[model samples]
Target: MLELASNLGQAPKAEDLSKSPLSIRGLTVSYGQKPAVFSVDMTVEAGKMTAIIGPNGAGKSTMLKAALGIVPPVSGQVQVFGRSLDEQRARIAYVPQRASVDWDFPTRVIDVVLMGLYRELGLMGRVRAKHRATAMDCLARVGMGDFADRQIGQLSGGQQQRVFLARSLAQGADLYLLDEPFAGVDAATEKAIISVLKSLREAGKTVVVVHHDLATVNDYFDNVFLINTRKVAEGPVAEAFTAETLQNAYGGRLATAQVDQLAKALA
Candidate 1:
């Protein structure tokens, strides 16, 4: 139940924690000559579920990529746990969109999950028994323990997402950057994923997700960052999930008549 202003004040003021588990200031991203994200500033708390919601071309995914250092920012800075990306690499995990990977490649679910530990394995290293155990544990966390030997291409869209979730789990990170984790997932799979994310938050891991469905935003996240090229609004769900805010986010494109009717029904 915190506002953006209050949350900024409540955050640790020291340079050490003030840098945040994930922090962005005046962040912007450009693909060639076109700017995808405009100047934006935000902070993600440790052990909380934060959702970034916006329409297509709103730069939600771009902001996430910038945070992960996947897309270099044209301006501003991103700091993780008070350190630069290189220093904080081990403490962060990323679950990219399911469509981002080459599913046609022949690989087992466990093999993909084990890739999370490759950073620790070093170059030209083989998976050891300990790594196998860790990967199994991660699969179990996502309810995919029995599918360890299953081929990645054979899994359903939901199952594929769980596999990636397991991979992030295997990384043993304190911060998770998930891009569209719910896309194309069934309701049951979506609920299961939400449960896992809640558990992660309970375990003191920061989770930042790029989510598109506006109807489920309140139910799914503790904090919401409403973005459309820029940050329109951000804070706890109740305060930021207002008609005026939604209108601002959607602009004149919203069906005002339908919204009025819905508001009257609720009233």
Candidate 2:
């Protein structure tokens, strides 16, 4: 019984780190002729929670999109589970920003979650009882099991985010890429979401969240990537989430200047 408990406490290993769960080398992304992210290199360890944070237009979202192959990168390489993304597509799950999705589509919460199984279902297939069971379990994980039958439109902002999170959970992938999971969410909801993310890490999933609130950076993340059109720093929160690093990443901007002045004044 003790051995079983010990094994349960250990995070499930994914691909080897010498191979890397997700690796980007000399990654450059451009929209048309304008470069958005340049010469970026980063690695996400398996069974860890990584937060990518930066101001608006900092190419954070662009980088994630590029990694997912949604947008073609001008030059670079992306590997998932030590294999090319195409080879490991089924092992990844993406949760886009709530603003990017149409919440008023008139779909039930359970139906949206079951959509995560579409890749496995193929075009000609319908959701089976097993799929429904998986979706229910996922909803329960996110504390939305009771709302499974509710219309997505009737839910609040945080509830909507939970629906998406449930969908990602249903995918049962090794890696999860989430974009701003806490935007506009109430304090209680934010805590709930963070708890779910921590649970994911405990369950041996690699969860990457694109975050905006800097105040909670240190409190919420195990690893952090500070990005602004380029890789500023990537490592544990204590090492990378520094004022100097943030200044460098957001420098040359008026807001950054104002912040610098405020810091100096306060000091």
- lDDT digits (tens) for residues 1-267 of candidate 1: 001322443456654444368877788888878788889888776677889887788899988887677888888677777666676699999999999989978999999999999888988898889999999999998889999999899999999999999999989999998999999998878988999999999998899999987767767788888888888898877777667777787787668984475344323
lDDT of 2 at 248: 80
RMSD of 2: 7.8
- Which residue pairs overlap in candidate 2's backbone? none
- The lDDT of model 1 is 0.83
Record all residue pairs in model 1 with backbone atoms less than 3 Å apart, i.e. clashing: none
**What stretches of model 1 exceed 4 Å from their correct place?**
1-19, 257-267
Residue 40 error, candidate 2, Å: 0.9
Model 2 regions lying over 4 Å from their true place: 1-18, 252-267
User: Against the true structure, whose TM-score is highest?
Assistant: 1
